[model samples]
Structure formats: structure tokens, C-alpha cells
Target: MGSSASKAALAATTEEPMEPGPKHLADLTQYINETHMSVAHLADILSKKTGSSSWVVVFKALVTVHHLMVHGNERFIRHLAARHSLFTLHNFLDKSVGEGYAMSIFIRRYSRYLNERSLAYRQIACDITKVKRGASGVMRNMDTDRLLHTLPVIQTQLDALLSFAADPDELRNGIVRAAFRLLLKDSLRLFAAYNEGMLNLLGKYFDMRRSQCRESLELYAKFLARTAKLTRFLRVAEQVGIDRNSIPHLTQAPCSLLEALQQHLASLEEKKDFLCPCGLQHTVTLSIPYRPTGNACARRTWFADYFPYTIFTLPSPQACWSRAAKYGASIETDASGGTNWQLSTCASTSAIWTSVSGPPSPHTVTSTMAFPPLMSPQSLVSSPPGLMADELELTAWAGQQSQSM
Candidate 1:
């Protein structure tokens, strides 16, 4: 069959118009409102018009619906889901990590334009995303999946925006198009941290393969590296006053980490300030492991350990500590029984406790006192859920290191 006829037939079956224009938009609005069709219906419509398969149609429909939501078309969003099972509506939308990435890029894009009123729409879009899941029945959290999904969209948008280099307004907003580019750069720094977390979480029903893990890691690194080529375009966006905060931090983890890796990179280093890779040259906070060499009366100085952990903001400190405490408790006892001397030591050197059951293991106990100004017992007490991994690691290491010393 010829492509156009096939596409038309597909759209006819699903009941969506094939072209972009006023009538097309109006018909889609009416179809969504009046029929409340499921994702399968939307996919069928898209496949018929585009000669693409049901999968592509469904994916495109998700992006379209998300765009509508961002544009404050709640009537459209509600109309579609109200008619169909929301889970069935979302099944095709969440097929792969790339679809998620594309939708997220659009969200992050329009989210930049959100005022307080539009934030409601943004929240609704986020809430609706919970409907889909993997075969294991584990639904991916929006925060965790946001970047993974948005990266592909960011690339697609960037390519489209590049086609409009002649138009300054489109050119200016191109930073929105290039959102994940910075992440493609400096992939190693983020990947190192990412790997540590994955390794820690691997056995917990994640269903990750080594190849998938490596591909994911490489994709992330490439995104970080590509940011450089797009910098000039981004600078133009900033001149027009785009809100950088709309998107989550590309340089740091969207969530928190457990083992304080003893590496510290300042917030500015996070591809946010200047650029990537070279951005690492910016001032970084370093933590070195130290062991006391002198007697009880002697003054001890912290010695440098080659291993480093970069610190970033953590959303929840107490929760992290609680979880860490739980994990520690699972393997051993409270272990908080001995002298409190570790309190005065630098965050890097805090590893005093050894499991007395056998040979001295390398397991170290760190706390959350290292952050000089940003994170304190006072601050740690206040963080919301979804802890920032870097900040938690820094605070935990600092607190633990002090006690060890």
C-alpha cells in the first residue's frame, strides 16, 4: 500500500485528522472531548495519517497531549482519559525510555514558561504519568524518569529549532531545545556517581542488563559532551530571560546517593554556570580520608586520601540518615556506642568503627556535617522527600568523619 493512503486509513480508523491547521486542532479537541479515546485509538489515528505503526502514533500522541497540558488545555487532557482507562491510555505512551525523554523535554520546555497558574497544569501532567509501569508492576517515578525520557525530546527539539536559525525568537528559545545537551557533556562525572548508585540498587528487582547499563551510561556522557556546541545558542536564550530553574539540575542527581563517595564539586561546577568538562576546573570541595597517627594527647591533622566524593544538594537528609541507619542496622548493630571523638574530625576521614566479628573490614561510617554553610543539622532537618544524593553524601560523610577522628 502507498504511504499516504495507509496513513489516512490509520487516522480514519483511530478518528484523528492527519494535518496541522485550525480544523485539525479543532477536530482533535472535539475527538478527545467527545470520545475520550484510549491510547490505542490515538495510536491508530497517528499511524493511519503518518504511515507509522501504532507505537509511533501512540508516542506522538503522548507528546501532543503533554504539549496540550502544558498549554493549559485541561479540557483536552480530561476528555481523552475520561473516556478510556487511564492505564490503557498511558501504556503506549510509556513504551520506552525515549518516549519519556521526549515528553519530559516538552514539559521542561513549557515548564520554563509556567507562572503560578500554569504550575497546576505541570503538576497534573506529572500526576498522570504514574499510570504506566513495567512488566514487574513497578511504576517509574516522574523525578527519576524525567531526565531519562526528556533527553531524546531535547535532541529532537534541538534539531527542529536549528531549522529556524533565521528567526531570532525561535533562536533565543533554542536553549529550551538544547536542554539535555549539557548533560551529554561531563557524562563521566555524573556517570561515576550514577554507576555507584546503580551498583548499590542492582539486586532490587531492577531487571538491568550490563549492556543496557553501559548504553545508558554512554548516552548520558554523550549528552554532557554535546553541550559545548550548543552554548552560543543557549547564551542567546538567557539574554531573553529564560528561567534556568524550570528544568532539574542536569549537573547533579535529581535524587540523593548513599555512600558519600568522598568527591566534592561545587554547585557552580554542575554545568550550570559556565560550561561542561572544562566546567570541572572550577573550584571543587575535596574530602580526603585521614587516620589519626598520634597519641590521645597529640594534635591530629587530616591526611589526604586519593579517593574523592563530589557533594551535591540532597532533598532529604534525615530520611537518608534513617535509611542508611536502617541499612546499617540490617547488617550490624547501632554501632553508635563508643566515644564521640569522631565529631571533631573533617568529613573525609570519618571511619572509626570496624565490625569486631572478624578481620577489619573497609566499611566506613560517615555523617552529615561536612557541608559548611549550605547543609547543617538545622538544614538537614528541613529537606523534603526525594533527597538530593550529593548533599546527603557530603553531610553524612562529614558527620561520620568527625566522629571517627
Candidate 2:
């Protein structure tokens, strides 16, 4: 009996766990319907509370409907298309064309209005309260009054302009095409505006040298990267009968702004004299016990140690020549008629050497470093193991250096 019980327990332990099954189509349909009802109910409550003249309710309803249409299942979408005659109307028809154009204009104006109001609201919110002693004059109290007074007025005006019905009769007429067009246009404009606003804010913060700008920039970049993935999902939506092309083209302003900011920040970071918040300038320190010579191997070894944390290709022959020329060094004949060369320190050379060595000190001695003659790329590649091992050592050293940093 004991042996049999143990066998059963082992069998139970070895059994594969059951995975959750996919949701049933009926359950999904019910869920979508319930969500739609919830949004509709919320809109109704808002409309009653703020009055039928409030645009806030209308806007919320429109956004909810657009979300449902965009993300809804095929059955619900097909029902909508058929019920609304969305794609059946010909653009050549005078009524259809006129309504479509009117819808586009209305949407554009609405988007502009929203943008202006949002900016105004932000400004007002920032400056509504002055520093004061009284309880009534407190910032929080002032904000509450601002919200109470401003929101109802804005909502009323907005609602009067574009009142949304729970069951929109506009959808049954030729206006459905116009409605879809407006939805798509508005969505694109809002997205563009959001990106533009972020770009402007980032620029402002960066100009002020605010530390918070870094976090904001990173978050914005991450959002953009995630948005790129949405394109694939949109393609799938198109396959399921939604007209993805009806959406307006995304503006490149945000991407361009991000790229420019990234490049600017990178350049700032690379500067050796860039000041940190601690009130000290950043500098690379290289300590070499041996003096630099004309030999390529010695120079390569020095560089390998100098840039311990970075992996970079060895300077080409032309680059070496350029550096030498910048330092006013040249090959010439000596008084004894023998080949001779002299090197002097230039700004670039001094900066480079300073970065490699420790911070400047009173006792620091300046020595004349020899510049190596330009060698072909092939010779640099075919150097001895001792010289070649510098590159290998660099790979290992770089990892360790990075960990420490």
C-alpha cells in the first residue's frame, strides 16, 4: 500500500500543469458590450451633472466611441459599418463630398480649440494663486475655485458646439463617413500636438540645465519606441476592415527634435571640460611611468592604458600625421647632417596628454614627447604579439573599467 501511494504522488508531481484557455468568443462579445454600456452610462451622468451644453461629456463620448471602433472585434465593427453606411457613400456625390469637407474643417478647428484651451488652462493653473497668508488665499483653495469656475464654462461652450448623443442619428445618414474622417483627423492632430508640446518642454528644461530633463527625455524616447510597435497592430486593424490610411500622417517634428537633443547631450558628455553639479570639471586621467617615444608599439601601449574604458580603433597614419603637424613637429636635418625631428606641445596635444595623465599638479613636469613616423595600415595590423596583445588586453580592461565606473 505504501509503494502504491508513493507511485501516485510521483505521478501527480510529474504531471504537466494546465494552462489557461483562450477566452470564448461569446464572453469577449459580452465584455465589449458591457464596456460600451459603461462608457455610455458615464457620458450620460456627466451630461446630466454638467448640463447638455457641456462639451466635456461630448468629447468623452466621442473618444470612447472611437476607441471602441478602433479596437472592437470584427463582428461589432461590421455591424457598425453596415448600420452607418460608412464605406457605401461615393465621394463623387455632392452631398457626401460637401459633408466630408465640412467634417474635416470642423475637426481641425475643434483640435485647435482644444490645444489652445489646454495651454491656457496650464498657464492659469500655474499662476492662479499668489503667495499669501490667509486660509482662503491658499494655493489648494485657489485651485479648487479655478477648477469649479473654469471647467463648467468650458464644458458648456464645448457641448453647445458639438453635442454627442448616446445613439447618434448622425451615424445613420451620409454623415457617418464624415464622422469617421473627423475621428481619425482629430486623433492624429492630438498625437502631433502632444509630441510637439513634449519637445518644447524638453527644450525649455534643457536650456535651463535642469537635472529633471534627463528623466523626461528618456521617458519620451521610450514612449516613441513603443509607439513604433503600434504600427504593426494598426496593420492588423487594417486587415480586419478598419481604414488605417484614413488616419493623418504622423509629423516627424518630435523624432527630429529627439535626435537633435540626443546628439547635443552626447557632445556635451564627451567634452572633457564639462562641469558636473559637484562644481568640478570632468577630465580623463592617464598615468604612464615611461616617456612617450617615436615607436608605434610604445604609443599603442600608452593609448591602451589611456582609454581603459573605451574601445576605439587605433589612430590611422593620416590622423597621426595631422596630430604631429598640429604640434608644429616635422622631420628635418640636424646640424651634423643627420635626420632629426623635434616636437612641441600644442593645445590639442596638451589636452590629450592631460586627459591621459592625472590632474595637473604644481610639481608636474612637462617632457618633450616624440612623435612616431606615419606607418601603413598593414604594418600596424601585422605588429608583434606584444604589441597586438594590447588590443586583447584592452577588451578585458574595458569591461573591468566600465564596472568600476
Candidate 3:
């Protein structure tokens, strides 16, 4: 039975006329859902197909995997998330023809997207996900600590999805091909989910005066860097003949919020007291139990046996925004029990914090061979409600299909 499914997958992907088409894709998906052995056998076949030198095989194999992800059952998803998964299409390449060469680029991008999508899903299945989805179908008002762990992963997925725009010419060459059409639709759903996720996270930091935090600021900067990337992506979309109106998510990405975030980041960077050496590289001070000498300071710079608890230098002045280190005026208490502030006698040996600009991202994504000037309710793919995965749960139950590989 396993061998049968493997052979069927190979034939459907390699021997089919043109693309596998919907019939074959549905048949293949059924095979994945049949049994554990069938799932493993099918996965092994796909890994081989995608890794082949033949571009057609790679494209068919990738499409099959994408279909399985969307339409197959849970077994396949777990198979992918297992410690050892089958496909290693990340560095896949094909040099058979001009179209293959061009298509190879998107193949790599797609593979990376799949790999990231799988891992993020695994994070949720494992309950290791820091951010959880809210009722509005997007990640919002997340715990700050969890955002630190989850935000970067979200950015990475966004970058992978947006990067599909990197070489539109190659894809343009495949525009008439089915793989192009399939990926285009898949990318649309992806854009809607990820773009909404990025925006909601930005919403967390929308009010700088109230929501200011080093972690949130870092997130804003990360998304801000993609400004240029977004521009390139849109250019490719226009070149591919996609109807802008048909795809509101791609066309109406949260640029205004990104700009607002950038403005806030820049404003902070511009402040004289915003950044300093001590923030990144602070002096090592002794804990309360250690002697107050050489890299050691009293808890209050306590006097008597060690030093007085009330009289001590405030932390040296450092960036006001830096959350990692504390450097400011010395804090001490006088006889009346009132606190007094003074400048720190000690200083950092070197300066650290400096201006570094985030690279811009073009909202690079393509859709359908030719999106109608306007889409109807039925024409639009309803992104699954589960795609709201705890916000960073990323794509909700987006990884609906999972089989053992």
C-alpha cells in the first residue's frame, strides 16, 4: 500500500500532462490521509521529486506539498514537524531551462516558507507559542515577554513570504504555467494572514508615550527595515498583471503604521539621553553580599561594616530607553530619610549604541494568473479562522494538514 501511494505520487507529479491539476492533487491528498505508512511513503517520494534536477518534477512536488498542507489531514502536519522531516527543499535548484532557472528561485523561497510555517505550527502544537490569537482573528495586545520570543519568528515568516517577490521575472516566465497560478493564490492567503499579524503587533506600540519599551521598539525597527522590500514586491505584482483591487491585503499593507513606528524609533534615537555606552556595556557591580570594591558597589553603598544603605552613587547616566542596563544619577538617602541624586564618578571605557537603519521590505507577493479587476465573495479565498494562531500562533490552525514523513 505504501509503495502504491509512492508510485502514484511519482506518476502524478512526473508523468502528468502540464500540472498535476485538481483531480490528481485531490487524489494525492487522499493518499496522505489514508494511513501513517502511506504518509511516510508519500513524503519520501516528494522529497525525491522536489530534489530532482527536473524543474517540472520540482514544481509538481512543491505544489503537491502545498496542497497537502492546505487540504490534507493532521498526520502530514505532524510528520513535517517531527524532529526529522523529509523535504530539504530550502537550497533546491534546477538549471534545465530558462523557465526552470527562474522558477528555481521561487522554489527555494516557497520551500523556506513551508519550512518556517511548519516550525511555527509545531511551536503551537507544543504549546511553546508565546503569543496566542485573540477573538478578532489577529494577534493583538500580547504579553511583552512572549512578544520577545515570538515576534522575531513572525518577522522571519513575513520576510520569507514577502521575498517571493525577489525574482518576479523568473516567475513571470512561468505565468502561463500552473505552478505560477497555484503559488499566486497561496501567496495571497499568506499575505492576508502575515500582514495582519505584523500590523497588530505594531498596534501594540502605536502609542509611544504609553507603550514605550525596548522590546517593542526593537520589533518596530525590524518591520520598519522592510520598507524597501515592500516597494520591490509591489513592482513585481504590477509586472505580473495582478489586479490591485482584487488583493487588498498586498496593496494596503500597514505602511502608515510602519511609518509611524519608524518616526517613533527615529525620535528616540535622536534624543541625547536615549543611547549611551552604559546601556549596552554597563559596569559590573558587586551583589549585596560582595565587598564594595573593583567592579563591586554597595547595595546602598552601605557604610559602617560595609557602607551606608542610604548613601550611594546613582547608576551612571545612560540611554533612557535602554532596558537591558541601568545608568543614571547616583541615588542616596540623607539623615531625614530623603533620597538625594548625584552624578556617577565611574564611567564606561567605550561608547556602544549607534544609529543603524532597518532595511526596507517590498510587500512582495503575486496572485492568480490574472486577478479579475474586482473579486466577488466566492472568488476570494476565505482565509481560515484558525489562521489567527495566538497572533504569533501564526496562521491560526494554518497548518491544517500534517502527516508523518
* Strongest candidate by lDDT: 3
Ranking by TM-score: 3, 1, 2
- Candidate lDDT (C-alpha), each: 0.29, 0.29, 0.45
- For model 2 the local lDDT of residue 296 reads 36
* Angstrom error at residue 320, model 2: 27
Q: Is candidate 2 or candidate 3 better by lDDT?
A: 3
Error of 2 at 140 (Å): 30
* Model 1, runs deviating above 4 Å: 1-27, 36-220, 226-279, 285-405
Alpha-carbon TM-score of each model against the true structure: 0.29, 0.24, 0.53
Better of 1 and 3 by lDDT: 3
Q: For residues 1-405, could you state the per-residue lDDT of candidate 1 as single tens digits?
A: 124323433343342322122333344545544553443455344323323333334333433443333222355444443433222232223225543444433433332322211232233443222222222211222233443443343333333333222223432323323322222221212222332223223212122233333333433334333333233343343444444322112121211111121111111123212122212121111121333334322211111111112223342333433443333421122244211112111111101222212112134543322211121212222233222234223222322332221
Per-residue lDDT of candidate 2, residues 160-243 (tens digit): 223221123233332233333333332332232233333234324334232343544454454343333322222232343444
Which of candidates 2 and 3 is the stronger one according to TM-score? 3
Q: In model 3, what is the error at residue 80, expressed in angstroms?
A: 1.1
lDDT of 3 at 352: 17
Which RMSD values do the candidates have, in order? Answer: 18.1, 27.3, 17.9
Candidate 2 vs. true structure, TM-score = 0.24
